[model samples]
Target: MDKYDVVVIGGGPGGYVAAIRAAQLGGKVCVIEKGHLGGTCLNRGCIPSKAIITSMKLLSLIKSSSSFGIDVQGYQINFPKVISRKDEVVLKLRQGIGGLFKAKKIDLKNGDYSNRFRAA
Candidate 1:
């Protein structure tokens, strides 16, 4: 059986940050994520939402650029491309977090360990 000084149940920002801090303090940490790392923030809510917001902000700025002496031509939003970009952003951030876990030597498990979990 694997042993861990700190076992984080969720992979959300709080949980992952806690695990990393514990590891930095010289503890063996494990993160059990039933879903993707970063939970709703990185997957659905925060990061992905922010990604779309950024795109929208850029579009808004471009639309208002004519008032700032910047001429704009026929431009439209490629929604499919926008969605693709958001997906790419989310994927990159998730991979980056996974990389950090590996670098810190933290064990990341992708399953529900609710009943099987025990602090060791």
Candidate 2:
């Protein structure tokens, strides 16, 4: 019953950005996202995992740095710190997307956009 120039589903990196860009281009846009903004990449899959992996890599490099004449000892993985940093990163990005949506004056619909979306 309602009209929109563009409807974006998923609200992940691709969907959100597309919605914002469409609005910037002078289209009436609405985003339907099942969960939080930034989607799987920002929430669970890539971004968080990569943050942990990078921390792991740092630990690895530090452990094996003796070959380069760098001596280190008593180093361990601080799981809480890693988790905290990852959460921090995700939070910032999520807030950023929210800010973008607000600035662009796009309508945000919190729902599952996998196979269905309706505007009214």
TM-score of 1: 0.91
Where is the poorest 10-residue window by lDDT in model 2? Answer: 111-120
Clashing pairs in 1: none
Q: Write the per-residue lDDT of candidate 2 for residues 4-73, one digit (tens) a residue.
A: 8998877898999899999999999999887999988899999999999999999999989999999998
Q: How accurate locally is residue 67 in candidate 1, as Cα lDDT from 0 to 100? A: 98
Against the reference, the lDDT scores of all candidates come to 0.91, 0.90
Candidates in order, TM-scores: namely 0.91, 0.84
Off by over 4 Å in 1: 118-120
For every candidate structure, what is the RMSD over all alpha carbons to the true structure, in angstroms? 1.5, 2.7
Q: Once superposed on the true structure, which residue ranges of model 2 sit more than 4 Å away at CA?
A: 1-3, 112-120
What C-alpha lDDT, on a 0 to 100 scale, does residue 57 get in candidate 1? Answer: 98
Q: Taking the tens digit of each residue's C-alpha lDDT, what string does model 1 give over 5-66?
A: 88899999999999889989999999999999989989999888888999899999999999
